[model samples]
Target: MQPEQLMLFEIAPDFRDHKKYRDGIFKTKAQLKEELRQLGRDRIYHVLSFGGGTQSAHLLEQHLQGLIHYDYIIFSDTGAEPQFIHEQVTWWQHRQRACGNTTPFLITHHSSMERGLEEMLMRYIHTDYQRFQMPVYCSTLDPVTGEIKAAGMMPRQCTVDFKIIPVKQAARRAVMELNGLEYRQQMPENIGFIIDIGFSYDEIRRINTSQSPQFKYMRLAYPLAEENLSTADSIRFLEDNGFPTRRSRCYLCPFNCDGARDIGMDWDEIIEAEPLSFLKACWFDTELRRVQRSGSKIMRSIPYLHYSRRPLVEVFAAEYARISAAYRVELAEWVSSWEAAIQEKWNQDELLIRA
Candidate 1:
């Protein structure tokens, strides 16, 4: 049964209240600086975890203008971002060259799933892979009443798995290479790292910790938050400099807002700019529920890409129909190519046991 679609405005007040609570728990810039200083490493490498978005671009521009310094600038591709975001990354790379900034700009992806989120989703749909990473909205069915009610959202682990961790690993490997050490060698105790994220002041709630769980010698920092800059401020700064200001997120990110919400992260923009990716999102939205209902996966609650806990296709029926038809062949080829890749990568036969 399809769950009822709730409007964004109906939920905005609750989100606002939650944000108010979260905003208070974050550590201030002074605290972060003091923590880094306490690490007391002989050398600290500063890295920018560039997201190819407005906030990070603002920081990158600062670096280009000699306002800041970074040992590395890294972008981790989730393999699901729209082409426009990729173009924006390239645009910034060109800008970097034009400014004669010779910082090592690197691109990396999830260590296991090199294709990142799309590969993960495809494996979930096609195989018995159960490590679901997306923060999909979920609903549960009331068996007695035959009604579906909203359950809480799944954990948003993809950001760590596909984005943050990849950047960390790449930065670690890059540093290792620079020091003439093998990838698997233990890091020298004298060296430490501080990777900067692009969370703005208004997005402080998103800042959970400054410590890196995977690497003891590394710490996470937020330059934008330290400067008390909001996302809007970054966008304004980019506009003032005639730079691209598109929000960088996966094409099927659950956080995408509708046009009515007027947030910069809108699905309408995706539909217009990258119709094929939009169709792929709709495909994932429908296939996820179908696979879940098939009883092959452990996730009991029905998952949704749309915020209303409804199918994305239904939410944008007209657009989906039009775009799906327009890109039918391309979509089919995409599906076929992914299926082939999944079979090659994940469907290996088990070794036979000898008696």
Candidate 2:
């Protein structure tokens, strides 16, 4: 074979082997570990943005103070998570202590800076008079045509407005305190910081395209992806460490499709676990549906959540109904109460507007 032909033949097989490049352009674990060792760990301050979810717990159990030393671990609460999640967070705190780490856990919230998800939902429905548009990417089933369709939402600023900004602020504060510097001075120019996010190997696309911290002094790092670890690996690590896994998220977060069933938290399970919180979710859904109906120039055959284009309550109720008769009855009661509560809130809002 010609030299060019031989080179082409050697390269052609790799194109079909998708697994070889599954992690994109990042270095392997060994390469990353060596690079870290070379960087002289003393100079780098690590700040873990702990999500308090399964993936985050896995990351913490595997990395924080165990394999990697971090200066701080921060959790941003939007003031919308269920009590069960908070309990798990408390457990996580104790677990971290037991693991022989004195790194302080910082709990921050957007409520301190701006309105949280609950207030945002209330204003979106009662005051702002804006439509709840569906995310353009996700396809939803059309009741009339019995086909899946896609649309767009206004914009998903919640992550940036609520989670990212608050967490970054908290991180900055933590770093400042650690260095014993006053807030008036600019952050230490010589020091480099790593914002350790917990994206796993399965989410390689995110690892590749995700933006670094906008701040010049900070850089984003995903150790899980660098190590080529997936959710299964995370779960195994948690099990091996004897720590229970729990998903931490806002109760009404629209991103939670199928009611967060991926983390074993379907809508039925949520309602059964926290009936009051479930009612709040239903009420929130009702308001978003109202906004959609009022603002959409086009009529939608199906309803959706504040974020989703699909009907939230209807879809969740359908899933719950399939499980048990008693569950269905409870679901009906919750829906009725949610609707009534929404109506009362709407009336009160209207009265305030007229006044």
Candidate 3:
């Protein structure tokens, strides 16, 4: 019998490590199934999915066959991510179509992320950052002293305004408009939505902290958390099967791997070489924010000179220069190293199935 409650399941193994909890790998699949069965699939009115890797795709497939027909899959593109991810996503779409499933892509302009930051920056500049300021808020504190550090917050409206806000609006729109084929039925006042998040055991902090009143009362399911697999294993399994080696990489993201030792080393070099090409050209330069996050030299805000009238492109010398002026030396190094690490992970050889 089709379970009564609407079931929302996040289809990905734990992202911390490749291993699954409950003592072994691949245990996530079984664990997730049992959890969904008990979670009362009737109330599960909607399924929310974010593609992170091949395993995430697999998770959606599993649910499609057993759980319920998908209402919609909101594919949020940030204009920054591995080139191969686009292809893999296309294949996923095709395969779904072959099986008679309708998946819609929620495309957006590059300004989605950029504009939000610009707005945030404007707000900070207007308020002189006082209203938005926090003590040791953005500064890397001495774990013990918790000193009044130097590094301050830069605009990071990407996650909230750009990604999260747009996603929620799109999902709501999908349910009401009936514009897409995924909405097979009329919209319900309480169109039950269960946002399936692929958070592993280690990412529990992010998962728990992801709560918000805007999305309150709605279902936020965690099938992967129930399964307990780490992110590392998921990537390995996906690669071994001709799926791909890369994760759900975002393009021009400073967080991507860019080191020579990581999995997809070559792509990292290409991206890093043309630093001017970063999506967030503002953050591309020295790694001030990264360093500030860690304990190190702080990124200072002059408050006066830092105020800008010209476009970001012409305002700063480079991504690093802006960061250096904003933050201190240690923070800069951390940011630099971190970007490198992220870029190295997804390489050219990383297979992307785009059928």
Candidate 4:
């Protein structure tokens, strides 16, 4: 294999032979039906956690076509998505209006960090905040020998922190408002919720559980998985209808592959669509390791956003130089603005503590 073709973190040779990876634990359609029966579908609130991406778009289209039902459609913005993803989201909202879909389409973000993942990264870079949420690739360095060995990637907690949990919180608050109760009030036991996720049949292994850990009355269901649909199926459906098919993801997501992978989520796509965001991603990639190496945080393993375990700027050296030259002023302005915003937030918190 060529150098670029090599994956930094490859699965073990015997990975598929392991019981955890080989054994399937997904629920059958009949089991899903029984679970819904127990929750009483007539009384339960149905929510589509619309990701503004291919798979979720398929589910949303079904809702628009009256094939499925949803009381609420929620999109959680991570604040680091490329502008094209946001445009696709707006395009869907316009489609919803065209279809006369009355179901409420709502946008939400993390409760504390309203700006979402970008806020988290900026805070980590500029402050003493230590909770790192991204699933960055990690490596361990031998101090004396100066040799580096690939450590495992960090846990992917950002999805739960900035996306899934925010959607749940927003849905909970919306239901509370509908019931004419305070947001902090406990939800009524009889009013259950079934939140539909968009994981496809091919991604069945991603399914961990049917129950929400935070809310007893809330259960997660995968409609696409239940229908045995693959991601390609959803993409084809969108293409046949002349809909937007760009995959949605954070600008700096480690899952993004090089163009050779042909997996749709590519770094080249980000570079082409939004140069500034690409530069921001490079900045985060470089700064994360710099911070980790500073010996201040609890995490000891060195972190890298790029899957190749190299600096993003180094991976795309020529493109980085070109984009940096082109967007230097704009990038500076963005950094300045975010720095001011974060400082203001910290000052407000300090005042509150004093009070």
Q: Where in model 4 is the C-alpha error above 4 Å? A: 1-42, 347-355
Q: Please provide, for model 3 over 73-182, each residue's C-alpha lDDT reduced to its tens digit, 9 standing for 90 to 100.
A: 76666555455676777776766677676656454432323433333332332222222211122333466885645455455345544554555656756655763534
Better of 1 and 3 by lDDT: 1
* lDDT (Cα, tens digit) per residue for candidate 4, span 1-355: 5554344212222323323335534454345546756765436788999888999999999999999999999999999888998999999999999999889999999999999999998887777777899999999999999999999899989988898899999999999999999999988766877888898876766677677899877778887877767789899999999999999789999989995666889999999988999999998888788777777678899998888899999999999999999999998999889888888886444321111
lDDT of 1 by residue, 108-167 (tens): 999989998999998888888888999999999998999999998999999889999999
> Which candidate comes out best when scored by lDDT?
1
Per-prediction count of colliding residue pairs? 0, 3, 43, 0
lDDT of 4: 0.84
Better of 2 and 4 by lDDT: 4
What C-alpha lDDT, on a 0 to 100 scale, does residue 178 get in candidate 4?
97
Clashing pairs for predicted structure model 1, backbone only: none
Better of 1 and 2 by lDDT: 1
Candidate 2 ranges with C-alpha deviation above 4 Å: 1-43, 63-65, 111-115, 129-149, 152-157, 180-184, 208-213, 255-263, 296-303, 306-310, 316-355
Worst 10 residues of 2 by lDDT: 129-138
State the lDDT at 235 in candidate 2: 75
The residue-by-residue lDDT of candidate 2 on 189-232, one tens digit each, is: 55656667777766655444222345555556667766666777
Shift in Å, residue 259, candidate 3: 5.2
Residue 45 accuracy (lDDT) in model 4? 84
The per-residue C-alpha lDDT of model 1 at residue 243 equals: 94
